[model samples]
Target: MAHLPHGRKLNFAAGPSALPLDVLQKAQSEMLNFNGTGISVMEMSHRSADFTEILTQAINNLQDLLDIPSNYKVLFVQGGGTGQFAAVAMNLMRLKPNHSADYFVTGTWSQKAAKEAEKYGKVNYVLPHTKQFKGVPHVNHWNLDNDASYIYYCANETVHGVEFQEPPSHNPDIPIVADMSSNILSKELDISKYGVIYFGAQKNVGPAGVTVVIIREDLLGRAMPSTPAVLDYKILAANNSLYNTPPCYGIYMCGLVFEWLKTHGGIETTAEKSNLKSSALYDIIDNSNEFYHCAVDKEHRSRMNVTFRIGGSNGNENLEKKFLEEAQNLHMIQLKGHRSVGGIRASLYNAVPVEHALKLADFMKDFQRRFGEPEA
Candidate 1:
């Protein structure tokens, strides 16, 4: 097994995933005295001018990277994607008199979001729930509610390795809400297509603890009567995400990540790299002569999380175990799949280089050569 530079291993964890080395190094250097303030960002006050600058720059960089519209407000709030599941319901359920919303359940994450939304209003499943979420149901088959407050769906399902090929088609009058937690910066998106776009920073953004909400100007001030001040988009946007002291260090780290992406040729370049990396890995899985299998549909496969199995669909437990062990031995760590659906998941986020992906593909080929048998 070849060693990576600085003795670091390739990490493919789904969330809290790999960050740019340059960002980490920069953070390390600034750990003691950030911007000559004589205190670390973690130790600084949220209201301080220095921290304010960090927050502002992060918002600006992200806006530029995603081409966020001038009408949208970029807010940094506490709580991960799970919190937004409820928040989405709490805030948007009041948009219409019926107090209902349409949810397109694709996989684990979206299903969970829909379940949470049920607590606050009438939840309509646009597509019937299936035992196995292998692909997105056709838009034409969706049972959309014309009077629903908003349309909700996860941009990518991390655990199931399923992703939407594009935004779902819906009524022009109704707004769309997307939870882009796993694939936020991995590709370019049309910000104007949705009324609300929120994501946790842990995946392709920055780190955990900070969630970024990009909400259209019109969507504000619609929170339910029970909505907390902290969770209210109107309040957060009004305060510029400074409501009740935000996640200081997490926001700072996200700012650094945005800067790193900008210097590395922006979102378009990252999108191309993401496609190439996922395609190489998928090619290996597809051409593995039944030695490997990806259950996801060809069109809806996730670029960030590539989930597959060893020894075919049923999956040989022993071979799968051995593959993970050997891959770890080769300094490739966090290759294990999610607990709910056990197999192997290689999360090739923006930070994961194409070369590393190719290396993983090569390793997969060699593993099959050693362990696989010719089909009868």
Candidate 2:
């Protein structure tokens, strides 16, 4: 309901996505003088009490939102999601020597994670895409190594628009590690199912620079000796994610975003809203039949990133281009698809209202009316 300064159009970029309006205003109002400290959050020292209080509240809010049990420790660290690829590998590889790790390759991000883990230990890759990245591979066919260290998976693939509606069930002894970079905090998930869950705040949380890691306490202190102190989870968790200089400003903004989530009725409410938005958009895609085709399988379509193409059989070269141009002219920005996949992608994050999705559906219908085959 609130409007941006000078009435700017809504934003729908994948990461560094739109934030709650009130949260932005609160941050702006406090930018010059935080809590009467007469200094910006950016200027405060990480060791100061003011900043410490901010960090504590932020972690508590995160724990509360995720319903993380006492067995799990919430960590706020730097290096974004990509950094965690190496961090998870370095820490978990401390398992007994000769143990291999299993990874389910759903999309580009998961593939990158598996590749990173191979540098440390034997990595068993499952469900690879030799042709083009599509839906998640059937988990029933996944070959599991009983002696593996752990299993890693990316719950949602932002680039390829693939998502796993349900978590994979694996051997109880083999821990599960997840990269929820694009869809963290957007839905309700059982925190106890995984040994480690890491996500970048830039998407669905707040801004770039900070990554949130929820790891079971038992998984700590297992880092390889060569692992750097800062990257080591044991050291960072011991110091409360301040082993060295932390991303103070980014963490503070994330705290504000957490507060916003609380006010919006927590993760369950947000998940319901997300489902509505995704369903509205996907319905339009489904009803279009041959007019618009989704590359990913129906069962594994992503709720956050709805990807579709205009031309199905005709293979019209400029159809996607026209869609982007017209959508932009109508003030629907950032609807262009990723360079890797040539089609339009609508990223509906937490901050995006259902009305935006409706507007998008309407536009897609009108666009189809113009370019699609005549209705029977």
Which candidate leads the pack in lDDT?
1
Off by over 4 Å in 2: 1-5, 313-315
- lDDT at 220 for candidate 1? 92
For candidate 1, the 10 contiguous residues with the lowest summed lDDT are: 133-142
Write candidate 1's Cα lDDT for 1-376 as tens digits.
6787778898888889999889999999999999999999999999999998999999999999999989999999988999999988988999999999999898998899998899999999999769898889777788999999999999999998999979998898999999999999888899999999999999998888999999999989999998989899999999999978899999999999999999999999999999999999999999998789999999999999999989999688899999999999988889998999999999999999888898899999899989999657
**Model 2 lDDT vs. the true structure?**
0.86
lDDT of 1 at 152: 97
Q: What is candidate 1's TM-score against the reference?
A: 0.98
Quantify all predictions' global Cα lDDT against the true fold. 0.92, 0.86
* Error at 106, model 2, angstroms: 0.5
lDDT (Cα, tens digit) per residue for candidate 2, span 1-376: 3443657665667877877788888999999999999999999999999999999999999989999999988888888888899999999976757757889888888888889888888888766545576787776778888888888999999887999887787898879999998888888889999999999998788889999999999999999999998789999999999899999999999999999999989999889989998998888888887678888888999999987777883335598888888877766788777877767788998888778878778888898999888867
